[model samples]
Target: MKRIIIASVAAAALVGGGTAFAVASDGTDSARSSSTAFQATAARASLSDAAHAALKAVPGTLDSIERDHGRWEADVLGQDGTWHEVTLDANAKVIDQRVDRDTDAEDAAEAKALRNADVSATEAARKASSGTVTSVEFDDDRTPVWEVETVTNHKERDLTVDAHSGKVTQAPADDDHGDDDSGDDD
Candidate 1:
């Protein structure tokens, strides 16, 4: 009788453990499925019929879709040598639109100007003393500025460039300039 009782208890524990493992596995799978379904739903909701139609209208091809700043953006190139940036909502509804001759062209130009200015500034600083470029950044209000941190033989320097003009305007006398103090710091 004692042996039978012990066997029954051991069997019960084994069965219970197996059941618990199965339940845990099922829970994990369910959670994963739910997460995937949610993502799909969100993607579908982000675009509206009109937005979809607009995207299809773009000439070249649908290059890519991305989420930026809580908005959906589609990159499309028109047959007329124009790049269209379509912003949409979570429901795929068109929120805003932009047409650029070339995407990132403006930014590239700005960056080039900035780099040239940096080179010029660095040369000037070298003339004065030796220094290294640490970092570059824009200023408040999206001003394209190069915040250059240079460790000169004499001192560290910080420089700001104008986003529109790509000109180096100011340089800090000290290298202790902190990180980008932008509103998006958080």
Candidate 2:
């Protein structure tokens, strides 16, 4: 399933705008359905139109982009594999660009952490509360844990899965800044 999803994402890498999204089963006993639902939303979202617009103010291709609360945070993977963080305003204009950072070491750390992970993000979502996966990201550092977001009880809640132990725990109030949220421009 992981390989299939990866292949799907790879095949859809260069896609833009809103795409189809797969929603997981709802872990409730209400009239809500408990099956995968196809919705219109980008799957990979390596970059968004706004992110690309903001990219005009930066240099590099999009590695990953996620909503940081109210703003869009993007990782611009440089041609040389270096990583830079680009923050976009509500209008999709570049508001801040972080300094260039080495992705080699960070990549290695994340790979190692994931290598030891027993629960995949999908499995973590199952262990969470049968909620649909909204997003999955690391701790923004060398942490092997994965932060999984799922919509349950008609709201989005975050769960942390230990990369090494596969333990699931409720994450904080979606407020943690690391390499992705690093830097403050003058």
Candidate 3:
């Protein structure tokens, strides 16, 4: 009798453990499949004309369109000669726009400024170290600012320069460090 009871209990434990394992595995697989299906469905929807028209006003070809946080983000080029990051609604209507101006404008402004309190590109770059002029634009106050991306001492940095004074208005250390050196290390 004792032997029979022990055998029954062992068998029951084995069956229960197997059942639990199967359930957990099946749940994970189903969740992944469903998420993939949803993404595929969303991708099939075409962009609306309103979105295209808004982007057309900006310069450069459309680089990419992505669905982000219930909004569509379109990256376009602007006449000012820099990339513009635009956000649109799901229906393809413009929600917000951020203009990135060319660096040349800052250089030219800095040079002119130095000649006569006029800002020029050389002076702006010199003040902020070396980086490609990405964009130059005026804020609401009409203060011209230059945005630059550069590498110094092997570290990448970004700077916002006052176009008139050729002074750094803001400087932010880049978090994306050692990216280019990664592949070489391996």
Candidate 4:
């Protein structure tokens, strides 16, 4: 009876130890997930703020804006028909500005689209959805349109807004179209 009692206690202890280890590992995973979610939230907020700041500093049509390595970079077509590459700090402060004089065929196409656009980048983004705008650019369609990429509830979505009419539509999938370089680069 004494030996049986000792064996039962030892088995119970072994099972209990395994349970504790599993619980601890699960808790660590949960903590990591929480941390990652928090970082994404922070990045979304900063991107919006930085975009606004970039437009204010450059005072032109915003072509594209993206966050890279803790900084925000914006490509803007100035009112004077010049392209400006604006870089801002994480705090939305302007840090660098450069004029892109090397205009390629793609650049010319984008500029033409922007010129024909009745809606601004901000308006296109607003019409796209009530989500965090990650990037916005002109699509190389025959008709002027804006491609707005957004993130909502951790899901990414692509939307196209008519540059002339402000109409919004779902963007086409990669496989849905062929390499027809109609000047629309998504």
> Whose lDDT is greatest here?
4
Question: For model 2, how does the per-residue alpha-carbon lDDT over 1-186 read when each residue is reduced to its tens digit?
Answer: 744664465446324333445544444655455565554333333223555664566654444455554356766554454567877754566778875555577675554554456655435544655464545555536556667677666677878877556788888664445546646453
Per-residue lDDT of candidate 4, residues 31-105 (tens digit)? 543331111112323555777888788777888776665567889988887899999875778899889989898
Candidate that beats the other on TM-score, 1 or 2, i.e. the better one: 2
Model 1 vs truth, CA RMSD = 18.5
RMSD of each: 18.5, 16.9, 18.2, 13.8
Provide the lDDT at 113 for model 1: 46
lDDT of 1 by residue, 78-140 (tens): 555466777776456776777865556664454344433423222322232324433333333
The all-Cα superposition gives candidate 3 an RMSD in Å to the true structure of 18.2
Compute the lDDT of residue 118 as modeled in candidate 3.
Answer: 45
- Candidate 3 residues lying further than 4 Å off, grouped into runs, are 1-45, 48-51, 101-186
Q: How many clashing pairs in candidate 2?
A: 0
Candidates in order, TM-scores: namely: 0.29, 0.39, 0.29, 0.65
Total clashing pairs in model 3: 16
lDDT per residue as tens, model 3, 156-185: 566766756667855555455567855555
Q: What lDDT, from 0 to 1, does candidate 2 have? A: 0.56
Question: Lowest-scoring 10 consecutive residues by lDDT in candidate 2?
Answer: 39-48
Model 4: clashing residue pairs?
Answer: 140-183, 140-184
